[model samples]
Target chain A: MQNTALLTVENLCVEIPTRRGILKPVDDVSLQIAPGEILGVVGESGAGKSMTGNAVIGLLDPPAHISGGQVLLNGKRVDNLPREQMRRVRGKQIGMVFQDPLTSLNPLLPIGDQLVETIQEHLPVSQREARDRAVAALDEVGIPAASSRIDSYPHEFSGGMRQRVVIALALCAEPDLVIADEPTTALDVSVQAQIISLLKKLCRERGTGVMLVTHDMGVIAEASDRVAVMYAGRLAEIGPVRQVLTDPQHPYTAGLMGSTPGASLGRRRLNQIPGTMPGLNAVPDGCAYHPRCPRAEAKCRAEPRPPVSGSASCWFPGEVKI
Target chain B: MSALVKIAGLTRIFDVSKPWLNRLLERRPKAFLKAVSDVDLQIEERTVYALVGESGSGKSTIGKVVVGLLAPSEGSVEIEGVDLHRETDAAKVDHVRSDIQMIFQSPFASLNPRWKVRDIIAEPVAARGGDTKGLSERLLEQVGLAAGDADKFPHEFSGGQRQRICIARALASNPKLIVCDEPTSALDVSVQAQVLNLMSDLQEDLGLTYLFITHDLTVVQHMADTVGVLYLGRLVEEAPRDALFERARHPYTQMLFEAAPRIDAFGREVDPPKGEIPDPINPPSGCAFHPRCPLAIERCTRERPEMRQLGPARVACHMAEP
Candidate 1:
């Protein structure tokens, strides 16, 4: 209800009608991101990180539909908007940078062409103006001599530089909210750092909020203003990035932090979260993470909804008291 | 102390360019990319040697070259002081191959879904003409997998369990050296740690050596006894794990340290590396990393830095010259 958040997802649920039954990809998720803040969404491969990002931009493809909840962008409900309106909003209001830059970028097309196309498609800009803006965007993302290199193909750029091109495309429209789904996962440590820093710097410069979907705890700790830990399409823990990442309240969050290579804990063997996330079609009866929680109780099975806490869903939660 | 494996001046060049006819028809220039350039490395018996680099830096190529999956364009590879690349001594190569198992990045891709876990693990044993049935149950149990789970397909198991199966398979051959190429990059963090810990425990218990190739610096920090930093098909630095990580002398290494996302105990400002990695085909003239090196000098542009000794560490840099 507040006008503060650039975007907010309230009890968002996504479902697909399969031959068997309704499959829930994202289940009862809710979070908020203030303008100019980076809200990190952390989870494993099927943890609904990308699903949440896709749902936010109304980019979910066929069979996948938002069955419940609301997505408010700039205090307006953007979820389930008309296709025409959604088209205008995408890449203009809520931009996206997919995981693989190569796949997302047109290999056959020059970097200049891709940028110009995105800009012209959404905005009422001339070819010359779009081309100028495209070159500038490439330069903005820290590509040296971007003006000259803008004509180069995607293959011509390194993985890190290609990712920068993707970012440049996303930010060229100067969107208020950018959803970067594992933008640097394919890059090396040094290059990953470069992309993350560049993205962060741009967000700071433009006051563009970002939803960084990744499994890397180090990234969440470094880039996010707030962290939203997800499990089985639901928010496990949502708090200030420092508190959630440093002094984690949820068992899942703690497990994630402990598993990370950066935690500075010497020789405490990496403690796994016990089991895998349940399939989207066959999620648990109650709390999704209950099947994997070492401290699960009987109530955890019957508790269908998340408990009113900082970032936990259990009958017997750990004592961080977030 | 004996070295399980020693590599000197190894390289692999991929002619990704089109055929002469195709190129001629398209009027495109012929090109060659040295994916893996000349490099030297050492692996001590029972100790893990980690090769860290970004994509296009040739870490994976080195792994392939060592495993005989791909022959090097130049240089020699010796397994237990016996040259394997010069000429494949059938008996000795078989012995070395059996003793040097590989665990790939993707647990799913590395495994055959059509085959049961038991078959997947026992394949190596069978290939090496070793007794398969004798080690099946024991190997699975040792890697923390239930003997019962071996009957199930790859899809049924969790990512952690799948990776455990990978470790089990790697151990089935009773290998002295295991080339783990991003083995845990595909699994969850806790799962990654679990696999890493298992490898460490196995190393201690069975006296196995490992060539741990990865982009995750955190994993290297936990497992490596010696670390090698590769940049554009060449090693920029090599040193004992602690020395390499704590007091990295190369500008690339120092910048890498800065760029890697770390768990901030004191909550200081994190400055990830500034620039993106350059094009590998047209890599910088002097130091491959000089393009992105903040401390790059004129000499770094004209002449390549030689790998030389500095204190107890070995570094390749003009600045590192005594």
Candidate 2:
């Protein structure tokens, strides 16, 4: 199943040139997603999870650019492609679903029109054919009365329904890879579950790869087949979801799992990761997480650590020996 | 334990209709949105009472009414045996008002960006005509923040640190109760754990009662001594933490638990809830949750079920057995 990688990110680096210095919000991060698989990217606010997704989709705004490495979609390099060419590949090859459905969708345009436009824009299909595809897309995402609701505007739909419409629009183009950044963050818990399952089902049935970026570890654990833990713009750990969640190799991953309320059921107090993630301008010299890590030693601070024996990037992998 | 806060038949209705001229022009009738309807709660002293619900479920509205941020259209909010709404004595009203504080969802939006951390924490104390000298620094240390952080602005801190400041501010007034509305929702998992732990510690040390409102079931299980589930402005279930999590009586409560993604239950397929939360403006005929409930019977759609004692919990579902 993991034979051919659908999406490969090799040493992807995203840099923001600030007034003080060049800030590497995403530095030397690498991971791969197989076809029909979900690679959950879990991280804190400034851990560059969203940046990695944006870099892959070629949507990094001005002042922030991919400084190094390549983003390959199914053996083809899309990162270094020309702007005009990359724009075409964005919808056709890699679709995007953002946190807010209201903002992602156009207010003035009806959802049916948006879906049809996206489908026709990517595939060489007629208007009638695109309309049919749009209806099917809506129906697949579990929107009730798809035919009638297709004519409704974005505002007419509820938050969850609007998200479904957005998903339909994203997949109506038949993209091979979908980059959903906090897709359910803006929704209610029950609605969040609905959207999560819909994304998983729709992507799996079509054999499309998904890069699910979120701050919630529970969401990652439930949705992703493989998990990637990020901290301070770097990959802390990446492996099978069960392994990474249960027997996390990196201290950060262990701390993350331990801190999740869902995982720490009977524990009185969650294992706190002391201090805060360093700002981009003041990132540490060696390991970015060394300052807050409990198992940090003299060696961890003095030198950089590569991805260890298995899937974690740390001087000491596996359970931390206090 | 004595009741710290008692809410009876709380209801809040907002007039969402257009103006007379606009209504005439559009040929529309008047509209009213019942944000909260006949919700009753008894919050015990020095314990955490968590209200869990999805969007438009009236959790936040209940919190606001409890904290006096918004007055209920009907019903009485009694604090320490004195009705907050009906009380005429200035001292009695002031006593209740000073004892209750609110922590908003977004730490970024809740704290004023321009104010330094010290002044922000001291604002509540100063509002009551109390001296703010060095109080911020003391509260800051109590919340596990550095005393030196007082001089720094909110923007200078991370999301977690800002949340700590918010907690410090809530503590500044020496309040007996705090209304925390989705306090940890905007935080990362590790940071959320840190905040939750801090809140728990404060509850113990200060003997504070909390009306914790959130949509996260895992968080409710982790933080609350008692849990209440709300749906479409109605309380569906209320019970002790263990009983509710282990043996949820209401169908909606069970659905919520199943819907939430758990780290321990990795790769388990989730049966997404069938329908969207019905429009709150025009809710379902009887049980607000009947449209989406799996165990919904014909009686569920015909007559509303009142909360009745069932084993260890009070459930508002006809299907639930005592």
Q: Candidate 2: where are CA atoms >4 Å away?
A: A1-3
For each prediction in turn, the share of the native Cα contacts (below 8 Å between chains A and B) that it retains comes to 0.60, 0.83
Tens-digit lDDT track of model 1 for A27-114: 8888899988999999887888899999999889989999999999999999978999999999999899999999999999999999
Assess candidate 1 and give its lDDT: 0.84
Per-model CA lDDT versus the true structure? 0.84, 0.89
Q: Which stretches of candidate 1 lie over 4 Å from their true place?
A: A314-322, B13-18, B22-32, B87-89, B265-275
lDDT of 2 by residue, B22-112 (tens): 9999999999999999988899999999999888889998988888878889998899988887898989898878999999999999998
In model 1, what is the error at residue A135, expressed in angstroms? 3.1
Which window of 10 residues has the lowest lDDT sum in candidate 2 chain B?
Answer: B272-281
Q: What TM-score, computed on C-alpha atoms, does each candidate reach?
A: 0.93, 0.97
